[model samples]
Target: MGIDFYGVLQVPRNCTDLDIKKAYRDLALEFNPEKLQKENAKHVFALICEAYDVLSDPLRRAVFDQYGEEGLKRGVPGPDEFIKPYHYHGDAMRTYRDFFGTTSPYANLLDYLQNPAYECMTKHGKMFQQKQPPITHPLCLTLHEVFFGGIKKMKIHRLVYINDEKTKTEVKEKILTIPIKPGIRPGTELLFPEEGDQNPNQTPADVIFVTEDRPDETFSRKEDDLLMIYDVTLEEALMGTTVTVNTIDHRTIRVPITDVIYPGYEKIVENEGMPILDDYPRRGNLVINFSISFPKYLPKACKELFRKGFELAKIGGGFNQYETVNKLVLADKILRVDFNEQLPPT
Candidate 1:
């Protein structure tokens, strides 16, 4: 009934939201007024946009299904609020811009003509220009830069059409400034629409910048968290330790290790890692891994003295209480060592 919105989008009345979207994308690409350069294209795309907007929305689709196109356009009562009448904003490019920003970004496009007469100049038929493949470049950032948000300026060399007839071209340099938000994940891509070289008889391509984090020797990143390896002497590992560390963001923190720093021990500093994306003033934990460094050489007398001292203190008395250490270790070497590699009993 009325305008047949479903027919405009080339989708069935019982079509799914995904089907509506697919049909809309196809039609939008086919009749995108800017690319097609036709007056009729503008009206076609408007109907396509209106069809997509109504069908893709569940509430709107329900209203439109219950009531025909005219009824939906005349407005209806809703569960919570009164639904407004269906109307395309008449700016097809604006509607297409909304879709282009969200979807897979597969669309042929050229410059948006300031003059409306340009739409009429292509009188015979609307023609779509094929855009070239996008160029990808890595935007390398230091850990600190990723922590603190900043702007990065990049230079691009592109070929521009020199003449009105588009026969001659010249190489032009452009600087694109990209904003680096805090806690932006690695491998995130930034897209610059139609900002590439325009060769003769060919349209310009899009530019994409992929974010990459530079390696930090002191601190290693694990998602939003960070891993810091701190070294401690054998004495400090046995007794106690405390140390101050300079964070990547240039803040010094003192960590106390009152408990014995056992091997493979970790200290977690909360909210000290990379900043959380979209949530400012929040961060992940900074995990400090303890690396114990033992002295290279210890004489038998010193070793025995330390063992006797431990025995006197009644700390771990029966763990290694063998009478003769050398004979015991020598006895167990063949039996205990490399059990997997040892020969089976004959």
Candidate 2:
């Protein structure tokens, strides 16, 4: 007597397709070599795979259901009087990979239970040697592009096979349009599944476009915040100054400098940064860091005036004169001072 495939899989002959799949999945998991430590695990797993292969197909199932394994080996005659050989070509590991869409044979059983569609053969089909890995391409975008969402079309060249034999291949250019959302962060990935290389025996790999923020000349980003460095003259650092800033949206913003501007001073303009992702109205803050520029060669009279001004300010008894002097002398050939008491307004 031949082995009973239905008994091996714990499914009845009258069981539905879905029931058969479920039973096979259970048996496969129980006999998986990675999960089971029994001596005959490998043999049992092979048997489970063979059972699924024969029962999953309508023609083979009908042959086994009627004349059993003997009929399967001797071949069954179709209505057209042609005898079709019943053979199992599926590998146990490959079956698992096709079900899970991954190469790992040690898949979590709970995952299969939660989403049975993940193991649906109709969805992922099967895996073959011609299967290729996903192709990842970098999509470089400017800060301005990220600020204002738009659609961009990219041109890509993909290989196209000429015939089923795959004897010849041709390169074809395809235009792919990608939607860029507002405040799209770097490292965000967009996937075009099964759009990679073409082969006769296997499904194509996925084509992935990964977002990357290109280095901008004027701005740097921290999430939704925009940071920029503004150069101010030495005279402007002491007195008040006004700066005209060109925003990402092509708007001109006047940033007034009323308080004393020190080196590393940051001025924040709220709601003027990058747009919040998915929340168009909401925005982050624009941070402006100040850099003071001083004349390399100052006249003796100008130095005397500056020294007198410092001495007079020191007489007021509110500033640290010695630290201020040291900073002015060693300040990258320019006066650089940190006024901790003069903090930026929230």
Candidate 3:
């Protein structure tokens, strides 16, 4: 017999629906069918599913709990027995006709041989058959067009070959927009059937919308959340200030800054932290990871300013400047900072 269903699921016999659901989720992560193929893994997953299928329903759980494994097997019917040939109506009709034929079956066979017809038959007979050639077309979509969700018009060329004749067909199809809900990661595929080809009998090929995330200059994906990084100049970092940053929503809003904001740093915050929740929450705070870009051809005025700063630092107190440079070059000394916008729960 299998292990106790409740014990295998790691839930008490009196566990609530929510508790059972959580247990199933935890087991699914470990025994995902697509990931594990070993015999043990498959057996474990099957047992887990069996436990859940029974426990999830109130009636099944009650019956199983009361009678154990024998209750499930009791009064179970066995496989059906094979019927005799004489029992079938179609077989009985065929037998009656064979017993009643007045002439011997060999009489017709002897007549074909007695005549010259048997010798006149050709060894090989041929028939002409026509085949329809399958065709494939080209489909393309921009990253932005699929993300926001709008109708897409596609032009496809088709080549039909019937017998020896060739015909070119061009068709324009409008694909209805599919809403790509936010928080779904890139590479998610949405398939729609009967929208690709016009074959009535054959199953129509699917129109697939593959999510290709653009090489974002400012955004990153973080498990159901979109992270965005922005650069803050030295002036803004030194004196804590608030600045308006643009987001996917196309609106600008003020976000407070602090000295803790530095380059290559991450700031994670809840959607509730943002002042702009439009029926639903959008992105939270901008992860202001600083980056510096210097022009190859510097102006004379700017070049001289650096030279003067270098000369003054060499003569005056400059130990801190050297230490800062050393820290930047050494990976061991690099620092990570997080400027969280939301407060921790009590």
TM-score of each: 0.54, 0.55, 0.34
Worst 10 residues of 3 by lDDT: 122-131
For each candidate in the order shown, give its overall lDDT on alpha carbons: 0.76, 0.77, 0.48
Per-candidate total of colliding backbone pairs: 0, 0, 1
Residues 1-346, model 1: lDDT tens digits = 5777788887788887766766776678777766677898777778888887778888778988888788888999888988889776676666677876532223433322332222222322233344577999999998998999899999999888889977687988999999999998999999998798885423578999999989899988888998889999876765567878899888899989866677777999899999998787799899999889999998796577565654644553553433333333344445666878978899
Pairs that collide, model 1: none
Q: How much is 102 displaced in model 3, in angstroms?
A: 41
Clashing pairs in 3: 263-290
Model 3, position 41: C-alpha lDDT score: 76
Q: 92 in model 1: Cα distance from truth in Å?
A: 42
The digit string of per-residue lDDT tens for model 3 on 138-206 reads 334333342344454544432222333223334544535565553334566666544554431233455
User: Over 4 Å off in model 1, which ranges?
Assistant: 1-128, 309-346
> Per-residue error at 301 for model 1, in Å?
3.0
RMSD of each: 17.5, 15.6, 28.6
lDDT for 182 (candidate 1) = 94
Which segments of candidate 3 are over 4 A away from where they belong?
A: 1-177, 197-203, 272-286, 292-346
